[model samples]
Target: MTGTDTDAAALFASARERLVDAPRERLGDLQEGRRFLGIPRAARIVPRGTAWHLGVLLLTDDAVLATGDIVRSRAEVRRGFAAESQRRRAELAAAAARGGVPEGATVHLGWHPIDLSALDAASRPLALREGDALVRWSAAGGWMPLARYLDERVELLRHPPERA
Candidate 1:
C-alpha cells in the first residue's frame, strides 16, 4: 500500500492499539495454509453513513491481527476482479483452442489500478496483491512479508470449505 510516511504510521498504530488488549486465546495461531476468516456479514453502523461489508478471514501460520472490515472489503473487491479476469481468460483460452485468433489477435485480462493517494493514514496499512485480496498486518510492532502469508493461506483452502 502506498501512503505518506506519517499516514502509514498512523494506520499501523491503530491496528496495533485495537489488538493490544485482545485475548491471546481469541488471537489463535494459524497453521500453514489456514486462515481465521470471519462470517460473511454486513453491518449498517450509522444512520447516514455507508454500510460496511465484512470479508473472509485468511488466517496465516504467522501471527497477525487482521480486522474484519478491512478483510471484507478487500475480499469483495478481489472476488469481483478475479471473476472478470477469469472470464476473459476463459474466452481467450476457448478461442485459442478452437484454432483461431481473437478478432484483433489480442487477449486481454482486465486490470485495475488503485489510487492510493486518497487513502488517509488509518487505512493505508493494507496491500493489494496482484491476484489475491488486500491485507494488512495485525501488529504495529512486528511486520511480516505479505507474499509468504498469501502462499500459506492458499495452500490451506485447497480442499475447499466443508459443506454444512
Candidate 2:
C-alpha cells in the first residue's frame, strides 16, 4: 500500500527459494533474530495455550502470509483479511463459550505480509500511516484472526487508516 518499488515476482521467487526449501538452521535465525528469514513449506501455528498464536507473528507485522499454503495476490491479501476476520468471529464464539471476552481484558494478535511495499527495505521497524507500526516478517503457516483474543485491546494497535 505504501509507495515503493518492489518486484513482487522476484520477491516472491526469492521468498520461495529461501523459505520454501530452507534448512532448519536458516529458519531458526530468521525466526529468532532477523527481519527476513527462510522457512519450510511445513510452517504452522503450534498451539501454545488454550488459545492459538501463530508462532511467526513475532517476526511479522500481521499474522498471515501467502506462502504455498494459500494463494498470494492482492486478492489473497483481501481474502486473508476476511479469513482473519472470520477466524476472530470463531474466536468470539469460543470466548462466548468460555464466558466471553472479559469486561476489561486484552490480547494481542499480529500478522505480516512479505510483499508489502511500504515497509522499510533496510529491515527495521517502520511506521504505518495513522501511527500504526509495521515490521518485516515471514514464516511457514496459514493465518489466524485474534480479535476476540484481543478483546478491547484492539484499540492499542489501530488498523492502518482506511484508503480514500
Please write out the lDDT profile of model 2 over residues 1-164, one tens digit for every residue: 43332333233333333333221110110111223366433222222112122223221222223212211111112224367766544443333223322322322223234434544433232223333334222433322222221322222223323670
What does the lDDT read for residue 83 in candidate 2? 70
Cα deviation of 130, candidate 1, in Å: 18
lDDT of 1 by residue, 1-164 (tens): 34353343344344334334332211111112223385432321111111111112322222222333211101112224357766544433443323222232222112112233433334333443342324444545333333443444443333335781
Query: In model 1, what lDDT does residue 72 have?
Result: 11
Clashing pairs in 1: 35-59, 36-59, 37-57, 54-72, 55-72, 65-138
- Against the reference, the lDDT scores of all candidates come to 0.30, 0.28
Best by lDDT: 1
**Model 1 CA lDDT for position 27:** 18
Candidate 1 local lDDT, residue 102? 26
Deviation from native of the Cα of residue 64 in model 2, angstroms: 7.8
